[model samples]
Target: MFVSQPQYEFPFPPDLEQPGSQHWRMVELTLHAPWFLLTVEIFDAEMLDCSMSRTICIAWDYDLAEVLRGLDPETVLGIVCMMPAWASPNGQWSSKEVREVWMCSSPAGQSVLLVDPAGEEFDCGLVPEHVEPLKKDLVLRVAPAKPRRRPHSRRKTPPTGNRRSRRASARKSEA
Candidate 1:
């Protein structure tokens, strides 16, 4: 029951750096204005690694912004998950990743994500040399809305014919 990995590279490629292959299950992402709900089926091993690894740690996907506020280490390594809701009105979204530090379970043993504002741009080389970037946990590329249902969803029958004409049609049916 052992595995071989390089101290877990943060922002690593899902196809490779993962403890195992990236098992992105069908997670349901519901964006309810101001907040979002994520039902992710993250691999159990990944979750265990979050707390078991002595040299590696997995942070929530909302702390990347805060890290910017603090003094970044000259040389550090880690992976960060991006928020899926930081999209702008123009439809442009942040390509940079986000990391969050949450207090889960009384003592804090979880790494769930929280929404964050995308006010800064990520340097081509954001993380330290040791760190790498992974694909978004839930990358939502929202394009412009296409043509909707014909006449819109609120289709209404035009007011055709006069009131007496309508009565004649009803009488014909009665006969």
Candidate 2:
């Protein structure tokens, strides 16, 4: 049996100076060939407080099949929330607080589950539009079976002779 490791791609914006201010709003996952693209929309709470909602789109890539197969009901598959850290009076950013709310596959593989840092679990109900295709693909596609090796068969070996000499002898006989 062959199993592939999941590859992830998370591209943060170049201008993101304050990593602690961003908070995730919504997450969308779509399958693009061998890659599962997770799109997360985040807004800065500080910007929202100033009457401006600045939303940014961040993406992550993963192998969803591998992820699902390896997931334990108690294990977190991925994180969705980003905690904020305020700057100190010296204009230096304080140590960022890491509060993560994670998503995982259910034990039955029929639905997704969410777990917060506090150990509270939530049921993810009603498949979203972005994930509908992925769910359908998983349902419709059959699991891959291990490749089988064919039985060995005996065969006659080729004559032991140099190719050039054999060809010359054959040419003389023909002439």
Candidate 3:
């Protein structure tokens, strides 16, 4: 007796067949890149002024690296972030801590721990050009937020010399 197996089919809807959908998937991938690199400089206690601790930081992001290279020296140099919101834990895209990017030939090869400006460490993965599309998305996604202007304070006129003060002045003159 011969037994036949039932055939199952997945409906490939028209949406899945479109090129735009494929591009969308590509863009979505950039949001979650798997490769990064961490280039850490030697730690200096005098420069850090905090409790005496020796720690070096590293960072890596393909898009982030390109962005850092393009940023003005004034933007990255000597900029101290008070409260850094990490992208790994906090999922915040706007981070001043990503100082530079280091590209590698593999996505999951040599790995190192990266310490953010906030002093939090995480393993950074470096990848080659396998995910260029995602880098574009990263650039667009991590654009700096526009500076918010503080509300101006209106100048308050001192209560036109109060009546009591005026009267006192007049009496002083008469005396």
Candidate 4:
């Protein structure tokens, strides 16, 4: 797959919900990527080598990370998902695994557990006190090779008036 888009909803068990609560939040993952990275192993906390794609390890929540760094690692939640690959009607492409990863990657509010790979997956049932702030805008930018060019190239030539400018300048200088 060229890129992957994963939208995940963390499954909450029966015990996790409050008495009146409708559901418990397991996790949510939404990803829009260009191409798939081909690996899943982790060498550093900053990146991951997945079987089908290379992904940088990053936490998108700056507010959440700071809070996590101070609390107990075990108290935090971990979301781990794995999927295959798929294609769409438009030229856009993606992987099923990427979608699984998205569940672990997306968090809308604060107090979330997110990182590259501190030690193990969230399944370890442990969390750090405070995670590093997310503004920490952990983003990956790729250059588009063939940006959709305009059907009609519009060559904008500067308004031609150099001679007029010279005359104006000369008149001002004389004055």
Candidate 5:
């Protein structure tokens, strides 16, 4: 059956550098504390002339602290996907867009929620072996907790016992 696809617009309008010569290309997807920060590198391509072209690379870092608050870190996985989209020549939309896919995995990393480029959610039949490695590869940058200083002891040993012990030793030495 032949079916037409529905169009989807990006949440934000693409930045227009020139009047009608702006297009963005997805260069890289970086997950910094995937659970907290998601960064995507995009290159803006603009035609300078008939034979020359210029591209400016920019990094868009999204802070998910507010969005991902209270989520369990161990089971949460941030999937960054580059989606192909139709963009206008005026740079109102980029050719490619980066979207963050939030998913949960089982303790054994067997269960996973997968979201495709079309925003369709589905279950991946089996967990990829690399999922564990990918999770391990994540470098978490967090400040170490400050060491707690213990309070000083207030009880003091009685001097009378020490004096008696010293006297007994001296008497034994004299004898």
Candidate 6:
């Protein structure tokens, strides 16, 4: 038997320039095994332009606060990912590689800063026009705890009245 997974919809911020033009919005965030993926959907008016995905290794166990910390004005943001060692003519060499990923920044307000492996900044044109909504969506995914609810019982309550009296009444009614 096959089972379907639940699909969750998150609230997205309004479009950047009115409603009937081009804009970018974050559509989904999902964990695919060892990688955590953030997907951005681009829209040209009502039509979908394309989708872009950015991923980070799940081993890092990054949380919302840790992600937002990269935006701190006083701190220099640098995220490095370690790679497997390779064999060379001389000997084995371990490589410390940095992949292109999204980094947060707060120059005016929260925004995404895209940096290449060479430490150069470039615009992917996929970053949402506004980022606060994206941040809120990330927080919801990281800590999606809902208020606890009491479990309901399926068994019906016992008939109200003395057991003997109820039996006697039932007998009389049958007669």
Which predicted model would earn the best TM-score?
3
TM-score of every model versus the real structure: 0.19, 0.19, 0.25, 0.17, 0.18, 0.19
Instruction: Report the Cα lDDT for residue 135, model 1.
Output: 25
TM value for model 6: 0.19
RMSD of each: 24.5, 26.4, 24.4, 23.7, 27.0, 24.2
Number of clashing pairs per prediction, in order: 12, 0, 4, 44, 0, 0
In model 4, which range of ten residues has the least summed lDDT? 166-175
* Deviation from native of the Cα of residue 165 in model 3, angstroms: 43
- Where's the lowest-lDDT run of ten residues in candidate 2? 165-174
Off by over 4 Å in 3: 1-27, 34-60, 76-114, 127-175
Candidate 1, 76-110: lDDT as tens digits: 22233333344434454333332222212223232
- Name model 6 segments beyond 4 Å from true: 1-58, 61-65, 68-73, 86-100, 103-116, 119-175
> Candidate 4, residue 68: CA error in Å?
0.8
The CA-based lDDT of model 4 is what? Answer: 0.28
lDDT digits (tens) for residues 1-175 of candidate 2: 1122223324457586466543233333342111122122233566842322122222221233334334331222123322112213355323221122223333334443333345554332332334322332221111112232223624345336842211000000111
lDDT of 3 by residue, 17-124 (tens): 755422121112122333332222233557753222212122234333454445442223221122223434566443334322233333434222234445554333
Q: Write one digit per residue (lDDT tens) for candidate 5, span 1-175.
A: 1112223322345463445443333223342211112331223356432221122232221223223233333222222322222223453322322222233433455333433346555332334443433332112212112332223635356435544211000000111
Query: Once model 5 is optimally superposed onto the true structure by TM-score, how far is the C-alpha of residue 44 displaced, in angstroms?
Result: 26
Cα lDDT computed for each candidate against the true fold: 0.28, 0.28, 0.30, 0.28, 0.29, 0.30
Error of 1 at 144 (Å): 34
Off by over 4 Å in 5: 1-80, 83-100, 110-119, 122-175
